[model samples]
Target: MHAWESIQASVDYIEEHLNEDLQIETLANVASLSPFYFQRLFNRLVNKTVFDYIKMRKLSKTSEILKSGNSRIVDIAMEYGFSSHSNFTRAFKETFGLTPEQYRTEPVVLNHFVKPDLILNYVMVNENVPLVTDGMVLEIFRRRLEQPRVFAGIEGEIPIEQLMGGETTGVAAGAKLWENFHKIKPRIPNLLPDGNELGALYLGNAKEGNCIYMAGAEIIPGTTAPGYQTFEMPACEYLVCGFEAENISQLYGDAVFKADKFMNRWLKQHQIRTAAFGVEMYYPPSQDAAYLEHWSIPEVDS
Candidate 1:
């Protein structure tokens, strides 16, 4: 097995045994490497020591349970292998800058250490080959829009840190924007009935540490929706990454995060230059599946 696969095996083991005591020697055996080598490889791939990764993951999970369940803090800590309440609180405060009691009373956006999707780092594909892993399918191809497309919806600005922090980082501003758009969508006129929605991110002000997020649907040109803002996506060639999930909720955060990482790596490997903005096309969800397509415009050569 490759080094990455070995590391991934150990990671999977760590996840499965998070509630149990994890020894370096046992993890090294899982990775089929010496203890010292396993530690080095894990740190290099995960950017965290094995101990730190396991602790953070446990804390992350416990935080969710705290928010949604009525479990006692001490019991939750013990369930996650924290030897004592004080140790758990100290670790939680060190990581999130809040005591477990404080966080449980009023939760906040947390920069969670999400599990690394290692396959995304190694997968490569083109139009002919689609990568499938963990019950999700990912494809990439090129598309061209023959004419400008107009989208009308609600717009909002989110801090770059919160945006990059994914779904666990407090209330999802983008999701709220989409919800607001849908609430007002019936009042808007001349929207295409194709059931496709667009969440476009404009990064022009990213240097200033903010992003503009627009959640809306495609509209016919010359169509006017009062009280709504319109963004015209110019005609251009785009590199599109398409993926499907078991449900719409699964498409956000984890799936999109992996797809974005893979897409960015693929672009860099192919020496492609992309525009400052990107669009996420959300198809109508169904009982069985949901689909999302991420579109990145490529810069035209002079």
Candidate 2:
């Protein structure tokens, strides 16, 4: 947490001078760090370089102003640090995959964070199906991911039972615990690689609407997250499994089943095992009820 104070200060400085032509050196000075180290650490902790993060945040908020239909794009762009209308338009297109006018035509890009904003209910809901003989049902083509640098995104390394709550109590607690994401100091977009829409999956006991919300994104080691929270996922092999269906819930059940199967196999081979907790990173919720992103539970040999 040494850099926590400095990072917050930098953010404050940026907000106050959002319209100014602040350079990287100026921002590094805000945090009292040398330019080179500040750039590296800031990217590692927050998942975006200082300039990019500031620009994106400004643009996201600017989009809000544009939606008001009161101010002109040129004025908004200048106010938010864009040098010209073309510059703002180009950046906006890259970030949102649409031009400003096109954006206004579509639905608002959801700005939900995976924090404590999720409301909860406590009621029992059962959606379990029998496990297969092998326990793992789907086959995943494993892909090597660049180890992402995540700041203190998670307090504790979560396990299978932790990632997916156990019974009724587990569901209730998980939902409430993950709701704090929506209450961000300054939420930034970490869009899903597939859809580029930034958000999280909210799972809960539907009978009572108790939900567990997992927010955050996969970033290269250079990128940074808000709150001085940073993470560097150690390099490891991952097994990815996906399920296609009309319902999102079944998709998870199948993916989890695969993970269970893999875990059992690993345990049999090693007698005991240690590894990073692996969780599903789902596609945009808008894709369909059938989308899922199931990651192999990250594990390290003991």
Candidate 3:
């Protein structure tokens, strides 16, 4: 198997055995690599040591369980491989800034630890033969816009860090917005050609809980509707990365996270700093395979 596929398998194994003791030698065997080389490759790709990743993942899962109100804190701790209640609480508090008890009572978004997705489909094709792996072509392009694009739909705000959490308060807000949008879509009127759904995250130096999240559909100029908002997308040069998905409906949660992660790494590798704001555009299959485009502006150095 290829390196990316090996890493992908390692991640799958880790997920399946989060509650069990995951040994380095065993994990390396799963990836068919030596322990030393596996550690290096895992660190290079995952940005965390094997032990650290497992611990963080456990804590993350415990956080969710705490919110679920289904089990005792001690039970959860033991179930996830923690030695004792005190140890679990200490690690949970350190990772999430709240004890398990405290989190259960007053749950808030902590530094949501998202499992990193293996970007197997992502290929930087400046190399030989221009190959396509995993039924998707990943490309980043810098485009200067000549005119502002207008979107008429709904807007909402979500906590920045909460973007990674499971069914979070912020995610609920977005879900409600989309729910509302779909209910009123037929009445909204003058949607632009092509079924492209537009979304934007405008951070603008905002704190973790103060990010702006907007979801809308591109519309022809001068279209307006009652109780619907309009966003005049400012003209700017944008770094856009797109992936053509073979199955669009399945491209939620992990798939979306992986694509965004790949785009971030690609930008960092090229030293292309991005603006606080970004947009996601979804296109329907008739145009091509259903695809998602992630858009951002290059950060200006002061």
Candidate 4:
């Protein structure tokens, strides 16, 4: 089976047996991979280690049970494998930003634990028309990048919660920075012609909520543009995912989010090494649709 197919099988198994103890060795065997390789691959693709994913899922289910107002908190916690009521409360608060009592009172919607669907290794895009996956034209490529590109734009270190929600102040800050960059675009020297409005992502730890993203463009060598910060990227092989959308403005951020998720899974399944960084490329509009690209570093073999 393909890497994605195998990995997906493991995911299905986990979902089916959420309450049971899941061993890494068992999951790795399901994926037909070694314990070490499978563990690393699962972490990279899912953005959470296997244990974390299982724990989060348990908490997520518990939250729902809490909303029902039926089961006692202690019993619910024990059912989900938490040893004590205090342990469950601590984890629940950390994951959902609310204590069990607070959550039970308000029952606010937490971030959805989206089950990833299979991301096709290849996709086709046609200009002007809405994208249809008929295997028409595949616009993907793998390029070896030997040098890093310098970027100048707005930078924001946002809490992951705010970043993912799109309605948070963190996202607003990024929007403001992008807007400021545009106002001074003409004055920025050495800007690349037809440059991609890249949203470069720097994620340190999957479990941590802190993430840094840059909204910027490639600049010429040794060029200094005032009022903008510079980020120097290291060179590596890249997998370029291409698509054409009707509204490029709305697509830019959405594309980056989806691409990052897909790439995280893709990179591990293929045993491709990549830095935790990704670039979002926004190109000029075409007659048919706005063209966009997501660039991901494919780790070089040692």
TM-scores for all predictions: 0.85, 0.38, 0.62, 0.49
lDDT of 3 at 142: 69
lDDT of 2 at 64: 65
Which residues of candidate 3, in runs, are more than 4 Å off? 1-9, 12-25, 32-135, 163-173, 193-195, 204-208, 286-289, 299-302
lDDT string for model 2 (20-52, tens) is: 787889888889999998888767655567776
- The number of clashing residue pairs in model 2 is 33
RMSD of each: 3.1, 20.6, 6.5, 10.6
Q: How close is candidate 3 to the true structure, as a TM-score?
A: 0.62
lDDT of each: 0.81, 0.49, 0.71, 0.66
In model 1, the worst 10-residue window by lDDT is 163-172
Best by lDDT: 1
Instruction: Score candidate 1 by lDDT.
Output: 0.81
- Model 4: residues with Cα > 4 Å off, grouped in runs: 1-140, 162-173, 203-208
Better of 2 and 4 by lDDT: 4
Winner on TM-score (2 vs 3) = 3
Off by over 4 Å in 2: 105-107, 111-302
Lowest-sum lDDT 10-residue window in model 2: 113-122
TM-score of structure candidate 1: 0.85
